[model samples]
Target chain A: MKFIVEDAGAYLQIKVTEARIDAAIATPFKDKLREIVVKHRKPVHLDMANVTFMDSSGLGAMIAVRKSLPDNLAIVLCAMTPNVERVFRLTRMDRVFDIRPDAIQKEANE
Target chain B: MRLKAVVPPKTQPMFHRVLDADPVVVRATLTDMRHRFARDVCDDTLGRLELVMAELMNNVAEHAPVATSDRLPVIHLCIVRHQAGLACALADDGVSLPDACMLPRSLPPAIADNLPEGGFGWFLVQNLTQALCYYRASSRNYLAFNIPFMEREDENLS
Candidate 1:
């Protein structure tokens, strides 16, 4: 799984570059995100614009990442493709994390 | 029962494959199917099919019993273009879900501190398909469902 990490002032933005996030990449993705979270100690804004597909494993990985974070630090997901967003909604993860329709604009406005 | 009867006779010919229960093979098969049927179905339906297949095949790869030989266990997948949508049937000679691991009717509670890391596979599959059925017969697990050729806008995130 490829990710482009950016250190925004308020949050650490990580853009996932893969088209599909499944069981194959779930573990590595979670581990990488955990490392970044621990190092930055800032709120994470995951950019899912490039991800066209996500399965339950992918959803679980995101949740695992959230669980691993400090209570004060938040992980926000943004710009999810329709399909990826569906998985989140179906699993009700939308309620668990802060999901933004457009993270770029949200970040810019912040 | 003949597998051809899964879809009506007037529909397109069925696409079938027997693949090793491996994640890489599952990914390749779905990619090939997407390309082959790109022109035949809408993007939404195709995407749903892809998600469902990924969940099912990956489940097999992860939890299914492995063969003792050098080769791994196998799964049979058959798909056909139906009048309403696409019909799919998958069979695998793997261990069935234990009594405690049956499919859930509702989504798990979304708690940030204690979020669940698994158990979302069959839930998504059930939510995305119609007339879903699962049963074990003759030491094989059979799963069949239909994906309608329409976009699912019911759970919009906006």
Candidate 2:
């Protein structure tokens, strides 16, 4: 997995690429986000604008990222695909996050 | 990491799980996979392999063209050390390797936006693993990969 960092004023936008995030690779991905949290400590706009599939491993990684925040940072999930969105809804985690319906390609460019 | 302990010390340090290739089991499978890894690999290390395997199994079960048998697909997992990395494999008794070019070229917008919900599984599987290979001999499919290996207690992403 690879991350593209974008400074979006108050929130740092993290564009995720290579899609699937799960157990086999969660450590590095989680560590990168933790690095961001410690270094940036601002509202995070997780531009899922580019990610397609996410299993529980991916969800767990995101939750890990959330837990690593400075306690005041907000995470906004934009452009969640049906499957990925379904995971959040099923896990009742959608309620824990600010999930917005953003177009896949359109939102990423923004 | 030299694991020479021959006895079951007070702490059981490993977890193994097997699940049917049903969609309902995806969440539980992931939860189980994470709990197993949480003791070792931290969130910052790498998290795609587990996701990749789950996606691969889901794709085999849900997307691959169903044969006349319509038998449920099987997924087998085994964890071992390869040098300084963790080696894992997810094998199935369904379809063969797909066109490499047709692999999900880009990470889609979100799971919800994938209108037909068909291609995301392959897209997801290919993206998660560090090294990926598909074997079609012996009338089955074997998918495998590896990730950096680390011991337990150091995995707090926080």
Candidate 3:
């Protein structure tokens, strides 16, 4: 559930620090991300490079967060590992979410 | 003096664990199980196995009937590496699994306005594993399935 959210003026960039998003952290992860997105009211770019594993529960949490956002705002998933990517691909959620292949470069932002 | 020939140990890899039906414990068990056969199986196969196991085990944790005491339901899980696939068996003393889970399932329809958050667990479980079977005996539920190994490119060529 450890994530660092940076306010990038026009949008927000979130880097999830945890290695696995399983049933253990899915609820809190959804709640926290939903809170951040609702408060900021900005498009979000979720950096999922660190997450090596995600189950159906984790995918459900991500879907919940997506549903919480305003119609105009977007949640873009970035740099998902193979394990995390498999869940989305198998469930066909990849078609629903805006998924990008590049990681949010921390150094370029600074 | 004639000495008997030494017997070599079993070479196949396997894993077994007994844990409470809790999300945290389920996560740890899946991680350890991956490491147990990481060398024997490829990552593609292991990842599929891990996902199926997580979905099945977490369902038990999420659906544990309300108990008067603080005790959690118990789950027993075992996995063995086979020639063509990884065989998995799980038994839990939780509520009886719904009959619909074992039936053929498709992904929840993707509605544009309001997407479904849940209902994807059993779909993923049914999609990833082969010969999935379930039964309830006594007070425990039993589930068994196999995750077939991905056919390697070299194997396909040969």
Candidate 4:
């Protein structure tokens, strides 16, 4: 999995470049996220535009990341595909994060 | 009435099919599970698949020695309608229930079955699936499990 961080002024944009997020990939995925926070601690506007699938491990990693962030820092998940959204809804996590499916290109217009 | 030729009941059960034990197989298995057991399964079915798939795939990856590059394990599936429920089977050519798995365990058993310990998978197989059964064939192992399949009659008939 790969992560791209772009400066968004108020909130940092973290884009995940991976097809699947499951047990096989959770280790490195979490490690990298932790590293990103240590270096660039701030509110994250996560863009999961490329993530096709996510499992419990991935969700665990995401929640862990959410809890570890600096206080007052917010995390927003944007561009969740149908499959990813299903997972969030099943776990009732959609209520926990600010989730939206607007495309990355739409970000500029808004 | 002319008697129709008697056919054998399907030994393979209902809608069950065999597929190769590869990473890509998870997609198909999960798809089938979702379609056939829609009510019994919830959105978390994908996570269940992830946990089961990880253990099975790891069994093959950890134990299946390759004298030949093409000798990966085979996974067989069978779906059966139990008394008041439904179940599926996943058979493989990997070693039979890791010997350490069938023994008495010290942990909570269900959640910690996949820890790094050699037999952690046994714990998972036993707990994740509703009813877990194990048997070893000549050169293969079979796991049969059954879980509750919710029904409209559950409330009305009860």
Highest-TM-score candidate:
3
lDDT of 2 at B17: 55
The Cα error of candidate 2 at residue A71, in Å, is 35
Question: By DockQ thresholds, what CAPRI class is model 3?
Answer: high
With candidate 2 superimposed using the best TM-score fit, by how many Å does residue B138's alpha carbon deviate from the native?
A: 2.1
TM-score of each: 0.86, 0.47, 0.91, 0.54
lDDT (Cα, tens digit) per residue for candidate 4, span A27-100: 78888987786568878888998987776557767766776677647888989977678656655567767887
- Rate residue A98 of model 1 by lDDT: 89
Name the candidate, 1 or 2, with the larger lDDT value: 1
Candidate 2: tens digits of C-alpha lDDT, residues A15-97? 88746554346568788877886698788877786665577556767776776778558888888766577657645567777
Going through the candidates in order, their DockQ values are 0.79, 0.08, 0.82, 0.11
Docking class of 2: incorrect
Residue-level lDDT tens digits of model 4 in B89-154: 777886556666655443322222222212334444454466666789787887776644345423
Candidate 1 global TM-score: 0.86
Query: What local lDDT score does residue B110 receive in model 1, on the 0 to 100 scale?
Result: 62
lDDT by residue (A1-110, candidate 3, tens digit) is 56799987767999999898899999899998899888988999999999999998899899989989886698899999999999999999999999989997655654
- For candidate 1, write residues B34-79 as lDDT tens digits: 8877767777878899999999899988986556546566899999
**How does chain A of candidate 1 score by TM-score against the true chain A?**
0.90
Native contact fraction (fnat) of model 4: 0.00
Fnat of every candidate, listed in order? 0.88, 0.12, 0.88, 0.00
CA error at residue B140 for candidate 3, angstroms: 1.2
lDDT: worst 10-residue window of model 2 chain B: B111-120
Q: Relative to the true structure, how large is the alpha-carbon lDDT of every model?
A: 0.81, 0.61, 0.88, 0.62
